[model samples]
Target: MKRSIAQLKEWFRRGKYPTESQFRDWLESYVHKDETVPVSQVEDLPRLLNGKFSTSRGESVEREAAALRLKFDRHKEDADDEFEKIENNRQALVAEDERQQGEIDAQQAQINTATGQLETVRKLLHSGASWTTVKAAFDVLGGNYSSLWALANTVKTFLEASDTSDATINRWQELESFLQGITDTDSLTGLLETMKQEIGTAYLNDLRKTADELSGIPATYAELVERRARGGMLPGTLYRITDYETMVANDPEARSAGHPFDVVVMALDEHTLSERAWAMHSARDAAGYFGKSKLEAWQVWYCLDNDDTRFQWADTTRGKGVIYRLIDEWGNDCPYDFKNVQFKRCNTTGDFVDNVVDDADWPNTHYILSPSMNGQADMTADETDYKWLYTFTYLEQMQDVRDASLINEVNADFESAYYNKACNCNEMQAYYIGEFIDDTTFATQALNNIVLSSYDEENGAAVKMYGNKWGAGCFNMTFHEHCYGNSFGVNCYCLIGFKLYYNTFGNDCDGNTFGNGCWYNTFGNSCGGNTFGNDFYRNTFGNSCVGNTFGNYFQYNTFGNSCNGNTFGNYFRYNTFGNECYNNTFGNGCNYNTFGNDCDGNTFGNYFWYNTFGNECYNNTFGNDCDSNTFGNSCGGNTFGNYLQYITAGEGVKYLNVTGGSDVKHFVQNAHILNGTSGKDSKNLLTVGLPEMSTVCRYVGQNTAGVLKIWVPADLV
Candidate 1:
């Protein structure tokens, strides 16, 4: 409402001023002063020498407001500067954030690349790829030391969880340490390859041998056959028969009269002959008689170097004769040639070659007869050196010839060195070649180290154990049979491997399986699934036993019978005793403590039936009257006696020396006193109740009265 002197000048000189009537109207809004003042007396404004001036509050108020506006403008300018400074700080913070974000993105990218590389290495290792292949892959995708370390630790954890052998784990640790300094892929590969070689047969199969070693070289026939049967031989293996004698000696099942020895597995062609280019030819002509049939003379002649067989004895004159081509046992081919040849028949029974008397006499020579003229030959020439020719004939008295019929017959009875016939002896089986021995007719002694042929259902090769009770010490024998009610009635020791079914064992057995629904009428060792009649040690008997009663120490027999009265030894696995097993006496650690089923009146040792058979009977003396007791290492489902008339001694009570109902008496210390009894209980090897607890205790059983007394240690003056 107030106006200054400057305002009055502006109103007088500039267009910002209103008209005089408008200014008087605006002045009407302010208070008027009575006296008039010169503009020169105004303060904080330019002094104006006006002609006349009326004093009013509008000038003062206007001057004061203009000064406040100037102060407000300066404050606003300072606030704008502060805002600019704040904005600059914000821009700087944003730039810093962007720089950090870039660094974070780069680190994240590296992390992703490392993670992918580790995953690739993990997959490659898991696939069992060779170390070389893995190294190649690692080279392709750069790997780090940390990734390899993580992979090693991961593999170690897997091995530990799998219960790998200690040596194997140690080897892995050694390999890890060996490669710890190297992170280069090629270096790791080289070190791993060296380690692999150092492991040797620990990783390699020992059965892989050289080709010649596996081939049946006359001595290794049995070993090769056994190895082949056990899947140790490579598939489609071919055995070489060096000669006829070797073939006959090694595999007698492959022998036949007159059957080509080398042609069984592979046929001998012209390439098999050493000098096939010579081109030999044979011609048959009428000859003498060998026995009942007439003999035909065979004239064989090999051509000369020209490769043509001229029968006129001109071009084919390398060797020509009515010669006997003889092959000896050592696979030697001998052709006897002369000017001419003739047959001399004789009724002798000796070697034909040994009788080389001049064509007039025949002494030890044997005449061979043939069905046709294909097999008879004799030299009538006076050759004194034809004495080694042995004759094979088809006569009943002579040695049977190696022919096709006999080979077929022998082959029909054998398969892979296992005889399929029913033999009445045990001589050959001792050597493990008699796989299908018919022991029903002849009882043999024990057998050892024999691997019985596996049962073949399709081929009816089921091995039958005899019914007669024979003592057979079968050690390290593997009996695999598709058990068809075959009982092993032989007493055997170390009857190792058996997967039988429905077979009974009648004699004492060890480590065998008496099959399902079979009764074991003998003492056994770790035998399973048989109804045992005799005392058993570590045997799990089958159901439905007949007349099975045991009295001696039944250590670990689990049979389904009434275990009424029986004693046991230590390591009693279960309290599963027999039904009707009352009045049973258990020694030391009988597990089935509570009277089994109906088992009563049984004396038990300490820790008899503890924490078993739903009975919390720990070291207590007795269990409840009639509870279902689990006979540990004994029968499963059989009623035992009741516990009514039995006083089970506690841990200390069993070995305690009980006196007459005296003043609370116990065999305490070295000296037995009446009431205030105390000394050193030196009954145990360690003497207690001494002045010093660490004093050595000596066992001097001076007190004869406390012989069966439990030593009660006490300290008194």
Candidate 2:
């Protein structure tokens, strides 16, 4: 049986195209195999094609043929569209593959060139050529070299002139093998030029001079000893020494900060000559270099430890790391004399003592030595009778020593000492100087170490402890108005600065101008000017509340104390302890409105008008008999000029104009009003808060002209 039109169409729709034999089978299904058409009736095919068929089989043939033709055409169109899409996709993939392959090929080229250059440099270094010498050879080769042979031969010639070691000849043979293997001239040229540019050409002249006459001196230790024994050179004459290994390692551009041995040395006496020569040779073979290349020197030798004594007259040339420097002008009887002491462990210059940290009483650690301490200059002054007493106790105390590396080390050591009881109590007590207390480091250390001096009216020593966190009670203090209790920086006559204020529990009150109970409270430096806050703690009349009167109680029932010309009335309980109704007038407090520090330009009348609870409240005018009307914390420009009682305000509630009102429950808690007011005895009117994006306005009163009212969204109401 033949397949139907529906089946063929379904097959075509699912991307199954009919073959030639299948198409023939489908065409035969429309017409019977036995029903043969005569040659006379073949003329009627045109009539059938023109849709003028009479018989049902003829019409069936036409309908089925048309349906099959349409299906075939649709299949052809779909196949053509899919073929175009596949071809386009294939092209795009080919493009992307070509792009990635190009990058890979370029990267491989770079790798090959780098490998070749590395092989070249390896051979050069193996020949006992220092990086500086090899670099100089590449510099002489330059970019304008004509042939590969020229480049190779020039580098080899420079190497021969630089080093006479057999290792250089052997390594040069390896380098020659590598050069002969390089078939490509372009690759060789690129590698050599790159090496030259990277290594620089700064020391071309130095290399040339070395090549000419080899420093005009005996280049070897054996040669030097032979020449000296033959009396070719005198004892006091300076001679230049070379360490080949040091020169190879002398690349300061490397991470190790290389030590170059290019120093000028001379012998003192005939006995000491061999020793000095051996010292130089042994130092090179063992320790690499002395961290210095050259030094100008005038030496004076003396016998202390069998000819181990020399005083250097000249100074060091450079300024970092370990260096032998002139310590003092004195020559006390010691082999390791004060003249050429190595300032090694300090990571700074010898002037670190005089210039940076000039403290006569610096504490002892193992790293620093004191050679000028004991009475006797003899070795029998003590058991370990070296003049120097090395110490590492107090680098944190040196504020001028800003080397973060050394200071970080000191901080770690200090922390360990605190835990280990290495820094004892008396030593820590002596560390309570002005600079140490004022700096950034001791603040954190003060948690465990500091024991402040009890209230001294003479020097105000307890008050100057800036950034001291009161973990324990400050100086056995409990409510006695000490530095941590209530009053800080307070003497018998005047008030000094109460610097430290990180008090979680203690009341850090400062007695700057006043005698006893003047509180220079929290984070407020409240004792600078002469008249801080006088007549404090019950001596109320004529109290001079000026210049850093933080929080002092001046109580008298007559003429209130004036808070005038105060730099910072910081945390100043402004006549706040007692009912200072008559004699407490807050005068000119300055600009710093910190945590209720200074209530600048705030007018308060008699009988409880000037009671500020909120910190940093500015320009609030409260009328007389308006007792306890606190403009809440950070509330600015609020006018409560009437009979307003018990009005506890909110944060940042600005410009609340209440002309004449009494018994108002005006609890505006974060109600950010822009020039709004309350009616007489107005109760509990909440300004609706809204989402930040909502622009709608909801006001309590009518939108009157010139009376600017702030609003929130209506949906919030």
Cα-based lDDT for every prediction: 0.32, 0.35
How high is each candidate's TM-score? 0.18, 0.21
Put down candidate 1 lDDT per residue, 1-717, tens digits, no spaces.
556656656676745758876576456444345355654456634534433455666688788999999999999999999999999999999999999999999889877776667556545544556656755665654434344544555554554565678887897687566434444444444443443442333223323344444432222223433544465544334333222111111221112121112101111231121111111111111231112211122222221122112111111222211112222221222221111211222232222223211121323222321111112122122322221111111111223211110111223554653334211111111111122233423222211322222223344332332121223433332232211223343434333222233334444444332211222233323232221111233444433232232322333445433332343434334545444443444444455433334333344533344423311111112222322222222212121222311112211111112122111121111222121112223232222121111122212222444432223354311
Candidate 1 worst ten-residue window by lDDT = 273-282
TM-score of 2: 0.21
Number of clashes found in candidate 2: 31
lDDT value for model 1:
0.32
Among all windows of ten consecutive residues in candidate 2, which has the lowest summed lDDT? 422-431
Candidate that would win on lDDT: 2
Off by over 4 Å in 1: 1-493, 496-645, 649-654, 658-717
lDDT of candidate 2 at residue 297, scale 0 to 100: 29
Question: Residue 106 in candidate 2 has what lDDT?
Answer: 86
